[model samples]
Target: MLKISSDQALQLVQQHWQITGEINDLPSYADRNFKISGAQGNFVFKIANPNWSYADLDIENAALLHLVHTCPDLALPKIMLAADGSHIIPLNLYDDAGNTLACHMRLLTFVSGQVYAEAAQQTNTDLASLEYSLGLAIGKLDRGLSDFQHPAMMREVDWSISQLPGLIDEIAHVEDAEIRALVQRHLHYFADNESQWRQTLPQAVIHNDANDYNVIVSTVEPDGDHAQQKNSNQASAHESDPVRAHYQVDAIIDFGDMCFHLRAVDLAITIVYALQHAVDISRVKQCITAILRAYQGVHPLSEPELRILPALINARLSQSVLMATRAFRKNPANTYILVSQIGVHRLLRQFEEIGADELEQLMLSAIR
Candidate 1:
C-alpha cells in the first residue's frame, strides 16, 4: 500500500528536473516512492493516498507546503510542483476519481536519519537521550509553527473522542465482559470530566503523530559507536541510568497524520502510544518529561492547559476504545483490529488502576 508503479511519478520527476536542470537516479523505496540519488544528490518523494476520498490529500499538500515555508528553522519537506502549478501529476478528477486517483500525492526532500525503533535494539542508554531529543525537537517544531494561521488542510472527520459517549450502548454489542467493561468505564470517565475537558483548550496545529517509528536518527560519524548506537531507544530508565547519551534526535517523519489540536492532545497521543508500546512505564515518563520540558521551555502551558492534562488522559482513554472498535467494525479477520483492542484494554485498565490521589499525582508528573 505504500508504493505505486505509475509512470506518472517518474514522468513528474524528470519533468521537474529537466525544467529545473537537476539530475537524479531512479527513485527506489517501499510503497509509492520517487526516491532519488545521484548528480543532483538525494531527494525523497512520498505520496499521501489516504482513506479520505474527494480531494482530501490536496488540502494536506497545502498544509505541508505551508508548514515547510512557515518554519525556517525546521527541516520539513518542500513540494515539487508541476510546471503549470499543480501539486500532483495532473490530478484529473473524473468518474470514480477518488478511487482511481488518491486524494493527493506529494514529493519531499529526503532527510537522512535513523528510526528510534531500530535504536531500541542497540545500546542500553539510548532512551534518555531519545526522550530529551524528542522533547527538544518537538518543542522547537511546536514553537516554530505556533504562528501558523492557516485553516486545517482537511475537513473534520469523526474524532474518536466524540464517539465515546455512545460506547455505553455498544457495550451490549460486545460479547466479552472485559471489553464491555472497558468501554463502559471509559465512557463514564469521559462523561465525568467532559465539562472541564471541553472548555479547557482550543485546537492548534501539532505534529499529531510523532511516534519514534516515524523519527529518523542520522549521524556524522557513520562508523563510530555513534554509528548505530548514536541513534537509539535503549535504556533502563532507572534513576541510576545516565541520561545524556541518547539525545541525537535529528528529524521527524510521517507527517500524514499531523493536525490542528490542543497541545495536550499532542502530549496525550505521545504518552498513550509510547506508554502502551514501551517495555517500561518509566521510559514513557522520561520521554514525556523530555518532550514536555522542551515544549514548556519555549511555549509555556496556560493554567487551563495544565488543568486538562489528566482529563485529556482520560479523554484519550475513551478515544482508544472507539479507535479500536472502528478497526473491527468492517473487518472481522484483521489482525490490526486486535492490536487496537489490546491498546483499548490497556488504557482502560490503567484508568481503572489509578485512584483519585494517584490520578492527581500522575497528572502532576505529566505536567511537570
Candidate 2:
C-alpha cells in the first residue's frame, strides 16, 4: 500500500538531507527499503507509503517521538512535517505515464549503519555482541516507554491471532496447502486465549522492528584518529579500542510498526526475530535475563507483565503470518515480504520445541 515513484522518493530525500543528488530505486528493494545512494557522505532514504490513514501516520510519528525521548543514547531521524500538519511532501504516485498518489509523503534521515544481517553473512565479524547490545538497548527502551500516556493516539487494529482461521477461510484460494496449514496451526495457538487486548496490555510505546539490522551499533567513546572514518555501508568509522569494543546503541530506526502494546510483546519480538537468528538458545537465555534485569532495574516489570511473555510472543508470530500474507498480496514487487517467510518457518520450529510449553507457563506465572 506504500508505493512511491523513484523520482518522488529522491525528491523527499534531497529535501531532507539538504543536498542534491540522483535518486534511483535500489536493486532488489524491499517494501520498506526506499533508496540506497552514493549521495554526499553516502545516503539512503526510506519513505512511508502515502496511503496510510492520518491516524497511522500519527502512530508512526508518535513512536519515533517516544523512542527519541525514552532512549537518549539512541538517535531517531528527523521527520519532515510541515505546517497544516502534513508530512511536508505530497502523496504523489505514478502509473503508466504520470504520478497518481492518494496520500501524504514522509522523509527520513538515512541512517549510517550496515545491515548487520548482511555483514554477519559476509564478514563473519564475531557479531555476537551485536546481538547482546541490541538486547541491552531495547531493555533500556522498554523502561523508557513503560507507563507513558498518549491521549491523542490512533486506536490499534482490533485483529488478533484467533482471527487467522477466518482469514484462512477467506483465502481458501491459497493453493499452497503448506502455507495454509502453517497459518491455521500458528493462529490456533495465538488465538487460544483472547481476553488480553493490545490497549489492555499495559499500554506503552514499542519498537515493533527489533531485528539485528535495525540496530545501529558503534563504540560508546571515540578513539584514534581513524574513529570517524565511514565504512562500506558509509556509516561513521568505528573505533579500535578493546575496552570500548562492545556495541552501544547509536539509534533505533524505523517507526512504521510502532504500537502501544505490552512491554513483553517487544521482548517477544526481539527473541523471535532479532536474537534467534544469530545466537544459540543458551546465549539467548543469558541475553534475555540480562536485558530483563537491566529493564527491571529501571522500570521494574510487574508480575502480570512477565506472565504474558509467551502469549505475547505467540501473538507476534501469528501476526507475522498475517502481515506477510498481506504484504505478498499487496506488493508483489518487494522482496521484504519474502524475509517474513523465514520468520514464519522460525516461529513454527519454536512452537515445536520441548521448552515451549514450559516457557509459556513461566510467562504466565510472571503475569501472576
Candidate 3:
C-alpha cells in the first residue's frame, strides 16, 4: 500500500479529471481515498492498491453501472470517468523506500450519510426499522446483480465465504484456546457443506462485505424530508414535529470484496454483522428474524437456504476473527484490526447454545 499525499491527490485529480476540490484524506484498509468537495458536487478520489489490475476495477465499475440502470432508486456511487472516457487510469507511484510501482486511479461520486456504526448510537435511532431496511437494500442489490457477469467475477477472492476452507490453516494464529476451538468446529462444518451449497444454492454477484462501517445511514422524517437537507426551515420542522426519525440504510460502500457466491451468503454476512450489535442471544434472534423477514419480502429464501444460515453465519464470524488475527499480527501497533473481534467469542457461544436444528427452525419461522 503506497501513500498518496493530499497535494498529490489534488494535482492528479486536476490533471486527469480536470476538476479541482479541497481534498480531505479518508482512512482505508488498503487503498488511498480522498473526499473531494467542489462547487460542482462532492466526489471520492481513489488510488487503487498496486495489486489491483484493470480487470478487477473495471468489473466493479461495470456492476455499479448495471445497478444504476437496474435499480435507480438505490443510492449507489457512480464511477467518474476520466477526461478521455476511461474509468481506470494507470499511474506510477513511489513508496517511502523510493521504489516505483504502477497503480490504478479512479474517481467516484460521493454518497453521504452517517456510517451505521455511528448512527446506531443515536438516542432516537430505530434498530428494528434499520435492520429491516438493511435487509431490503441487500435483497434489491443482489437482485440487480443477478444478470451481471464478468470474467473477473470468477476470480478467487480471499474474503468469499466459499474460501473458508483455506483459512483453516490460519486458525492456529488465534491465541485463546477456547476461541480457537469454536472457530475449528465451525470451519469443519463449513467444509462438509460447502460443496452441497455450491450445487444447490442460487448464485449471484454480491456486495459481499456489509459490515457496519461499510453501510451509510440516513434518517427520514414523517413529512418525507431527509435529515441531510440543509434547509433551516426543514431543520426547525424536525425539531418541533415530536416525531421520531426513521433510520434506513441509504447506501452500501466498499465493494472491494465483491465476488460471485451463493446469494444466501450475502444474507448470512448481513445477519452476522447485525448480530454483532446485539447484547444477548434474545436480541440476536430478534435481529435475525427482522432481517430474514424483510429480505424474504423482497427475495424469498429457499428451505435449504434457511437451513444453512446458522452454519454460514458461524463460518463468516470465524473468517472475520481469523483474518483480523493475521492482520493484527503483521501490524501489532494497529489495534483497530482487532476491533471486530470484540464479543465474537460470546456470539459464537450463543450460536452453539441455540444449536443448528433449533436455529434452522427460527429462520424458517422468520420467513413464514
Candidate 2 positional error at 137, Å: 1.8
Query: Can you write out model 1's per-residue Cα lDDT over 119-145, one digit (the tens) per residue?
Result: 745555445545545555666666655
Whole-model Cα lDDT per candidate?
A: 0.56, 0.54, 0.82
Worst-scoring 10-residue span by lDDT in model 2? 228-237
- lDDT of prediction 2: 0.54
| CA deviation > 4 Å runs, candidate 1 | 1-8, 16-33, 47-55, 66-70, 85-89, 92-103, 121-125, 158-179, 191-202, 219-247, 340-344, 354-356, 365-368
The digit string of per-residue lDDT tens for model 3 on 52-77 reads: 88888888899998999877767989
**TM-score of every candidate:** 0.74, 0.68, 0.91
Best by TM-score: 3
lDDT of 2 by residue, 1-368 (tens): 34566676666656554545656564422233454456344444544454456666666665566667766765656554444445534445544456564555555556666554544443323234444455557777767666555553435443323344455442343335765565566566556644445445565666667766666656443323123211211221232334334344566666556665556667777666654453344444443444444445455666666766666665666566666667677887887776756755555454555266666554443223
- For every model in order, what is the number of clashing pairs? 15, 11, 0
lDDT of 2 at 256: 56
TM-score of 1: 0.74
Candidate 2 vs candidate 3: the lDDT winner is: 3
Error of 3 at 331 (Å): 3.8
